[model samples]
Target: MISTSPRATSVAGEPDAMSAREVLDLARSQQAAEDAAAARKLEAAARWADLHPPQSRHHAASFTLDGIEHEEAIAGDGCPTVAEFCIAELGTVLGISTTAAKRLIGHALELRHRLPRLWAAVHAGCVPAWRARLVAEATIHATPALTPASVAWIDAQVTPFAAKVGPAQLDRLVAEAIARQHPAEPVDPDDPHPACPDGRHVTIDADQVGFGGTTSVAAQLDLADALDLDHALQTGAAELKALGSTESLGARRAMALGHLARRQLALDLASATRLAADTDLAGQPTSLPAARALEFHLHFSAGLAGGLEIDHLGRMDEGQRLMVLDLVKSWCGDSHTKITVKPVIDLNTELTAPGYQPTGRQREQIALRDRTCVFPWCSQPARRCDLDHTVPFDHHAACDDPAQPGATTTSNLGALCRRHHRLKTHGRWQVSQPASGVFRWTSPHGHTYRRDSTGTTRVDSDPDPPAPPNRSSRAA
Candidate 1:
């Protein structure tokens, strides 16, 4: 027989004892009450600006909290503005750091001035304060030159949908709205200069030394220079792979980058010619020979070739694309190097492969389409990830599924980084590709996340929530 406590006996005898459902209902009721209280607190904080008035130099306010006396000083002309006073007062009252308090005050100011609808929603307890804050922050970041009219427009567009979507989706909607409003300037052919006045510079910093007398170096370089160096490292890494290096791709690439640097330094030292030919000789020894050939890839949509549209990465403008093409043509003409253009097609009808492994051509197309890992929040390049099937290949095969056969096609495959791949395989995360290059991910908690070429977003329920406004058009 199991021993029972007097409390258990009393609970068993009591008719008022709560059932599982009753307990859950009571807990939910408590949560709703707490949420309402929290919303009221946020509303009060947001209204602090209206409640407190700036004080003049001659008029000061002193307050005593706990045991310490604090004085509020003037911010301008020996007076404290409402914002400054709020920050100081809130920091002390909330027991938060001054920086955090200042941020809180800034958020309050933004809500009051820029996001009236969201503020109203939060005050009514219809929208969570955190979600409202997210919308406000996203709008502020996306539209740096925000005006009263623009803020009102953003509020109108976002307020209706903000309560229905998660933070990630709200962020994307705000970003898309901003992009539509402020399309990038058309690329100019004559503007071929670094964005920064200072040309690229590289500096190495000393990091911790490791075992075997190995030293670690940290360096920062400009984007273009860094990309060039990375490309060289990739080439070197490919060579190492051909020579049968046992190291992983990431490790090999690291070694290859260092090797390339050492090789360049050795070549520079061994040259017989003076560093400046004119300094050693009466005049320049001879015109320098043509520079070495350089090869790089550029991928863009056919429709974007003539239009002033941003590239897939959103980093290259139309003018930059034209500059790149012009430079490539000039280099090829001077060096007599052949240029090959290959088209990447998304095959929805063609089922050329039956096995679980994707064909080499299919892999290339998938890499080009994805550009980066398909996992949520992961920015790892597609080249470095494994192509994962949305459905378990073996499970499909075992079900005697001859109609589609779960063929290794583009629609069924996605590139996932190693970490995420394991998470999906063994963890509670589930993924499904409802359309080509579109992924829907379900978490253990039942929340869903969607990802496409643009970015990832967490949704409430809709599988294909009305596609966020078209980025190509204005006033979307």
Candidate 2:
């Protein structure tokens, strides 16, 4: 029966006569071989996870989901799948979230995408699991966030390893790592280490490459740790640059930095712009700027000399204009000291005319300049921005004669995207444009910085469109 069932395998006309003892020994040997294969696979898995530990605890915490871990924990007695165990280990040992852990294991399953040697090296404990997974991911997907040039560069580098995976996934993995390795703003060129007012130090660097084009990478860092990162990035960058592009070390390091840059931006863009929870105000819905709000201070020479106060106008129906007139009267006093007034808003970043009532052809110039967002870290096109008056046109102090006409002039108007507009108006921020296109902002405490418009040129290429369905982003 066994011979007829196809399980019995023997060369035709050979081994027809065999003892029961021999048959038992052969069966045992086959089982032993199978057990050995399982053991090797188990060892490979152990080697892999031990090396790649995932990213920072915060990243693991934020990106990872929890439900997956709960499921694995319940499957105690029965051994879980390789993926399940990997996810559980990251969560338990590294304290990473289950979602991120699952992502890591998922990358491991697609061996055809990554370099076999890199994979083996990871399993052999030579490379860190986070880095290994980075390599693994680069081998699989073509993430759209990466720029065409970077994608091309990655494509070239991974071609030799194409036997393992296609160009698309390889680019993705490289793009991911390059995105993660650096900060948003290049360390302040002066301090080499600068922090935001909220006490987070900026770590982004402009020179660093990403899946996308070059961008400033920013992050809060431990001063000492930041210094260490600065040295590593700077020094490694120098060495690879010196080695030239053809060298393996140079190419690998460059690709790695590209991955780090993109990942870091993705991380920062999320946290750096968290908004307040309140959405609806009275009957109308209000959306806070994605970033911090900007507040403007209209300083007057003296308290409104003869102006009406907001309290006095409580019964008036025309509150908006009355509010403007009241502010003008107070600041118009002849006292040498300037009187100040401020109007604030949560939704729009730029301080616009109270009722979208822009003065004169101010709107025409704003459209012409289409002045892109002036924030140092951002480059959103002007069509997406709101028109802001350098000097609030409504304030009397801002006018030549409050009675003659509202303050309106081309030079006084600037385009600030919603976020920077909010940041300037609400956050006690000040901007100074020493040159035509360049504008420098002074923080509330008087720290001065500038955003140069040097690299804001249009690109004219139809490279492979960014993946997914978005056509505009592809061209952009």
Candidate 3:
């Protein structure tokens, strides 16, 4: 007999091998299982949100749901309030980042409370959870905010087509709903982000720097500004070619953007001089603007083909390592870059601090030692994370007191992303540091994880005593 259980892996219980038709049937069953799993994820997220009511007294966002007012700790046009650190833990458990988990939870809550018809379709399995979540997210984030009647109207419009709707169709439906809600301000269904002054934006995703030392750049600017930048890039690319740079136009344009960032182009334009000739770009124009100090995080081991992580640009492969060295040499040697020397930090050296705040040198050593957030599977750069004392700092205790704990020192410090740090502070989790750069974390649910210089690992899951009540997280 073929097991109908969702967890069953076999297509035929008695078979040595499945037939072709049975194999195809198994694929269909897997699809159904995936849909069921997606539904469960949403349900679990919604339940988690329900378990964590907003605790901050500082929020101004209040909305009514089921005749009860909810003071949202996050965006509060009309969503249920949730505890600040709740999303991060859920995100970590789900192998996603906090922001992504928050969006998933928000979509789930919006579907459950505001868009009942679509929500019903999802639970009935007529609409996939992904499709319904998309509709929910669109309605929840619509500008001018939808009235309850408008939302109900949207629910009715989408529920029938929920299974097949795409973002383009969803955008049109939301725009139509917006128009119906406000007769005075008609919305163009075709125009998503209207060409309003407020809509012009330049956004950077610093977290997305790839190992190839490149980042994704996006911008929507005024027509004149856009044209001006294009012209500047063209000029810079032309100048690079003139100076014998053989890189592609795209690469040259990238370098041009860097020049703009360093005020190199600005200074030249201000002087009203053409690109100077000094054999290469090194000889170009005026002296390079004062540059930020560069810190190279390099590792050396045998023919071991060690690793290197550059600031801002991220990791560069050794085969393409000239990409980093050449880029640095171009900036420093060609661009007349300024070099400031600082003593190298010995990662083995442990330092002490007399106060709760770690010294700058101490922070650098810790950053170098950990290199990334001290959380299981978390890759957030340590330099960007908060220096947390495993023993929470107590302002009441004297630093020199023999009995006092929570001293700020290298041995006591590890880096954690803000959400994880807030989770530790307010999510009723516990952490202990047995050695410098070695930490053990205990989740509220009792799973223990160890983080060290090598990486993070889950050591065990022993039942922990019940955790304390949730507390409000301090604002980042």
lDDT per residue as tens, model 1, 39-154: 67665655664566544435444542331222322211211236343343444344444445555555555666677887788777787777777766665555345565776777
Over 1-476, each residue of candidate 3 has an lDDT whose tens digit, in order, gives 55565444554544345566877999999988898888888889889989988765465456533422333433224568787666766776776666788788888888887888887787777888888877777777667777777888878877887676676886676677666765665568899875543678888764554455466789989899999999999999888888888999999999888887776752343234545552345664554345444444433221324655333332322212223444545556644356755566666566889888899988778776777888766777787899998887788989887666888877789999976776776566788877777787776777676677676666675333232222221111
- Most accurate candidate by TM-score: 3
Q: What is the C-alpha lDDT of each candidate?
A: 0.59, 0.43, 0.69
Q: Could you give candidate 2's per-residue lDDT for residues 26-138 as a string of tens digits?
A: 99888666545533443454455545443344534556543232222211112223423334333323333334545544555433222445445444544434454555455
TM-score of each: 0.38, 0.24, 0.72
- Candidate 1 structure, TM-score to reference: 0.38
Candidate number with the higher lDDT (1 or 2): 1
lDDT: which candidate is best? Answer: 3
User: Is candidate 1 or 3 superior in lDDT?
Assistant: 3
Residue 277 accuracy (lDDT) in model 1: 37
What are the C-alpha RMSDs, in order, of all predicted structures?
A: 26.4, 29.4, 9.2
Candidate 3 pairs with clashing backbones: none
Comparing 1 with 3 on TM-score, the higher-scoring candidate is 3
Clashing pairs in 1: 74-79, 74-80, 75-79, 75-80, 187-319
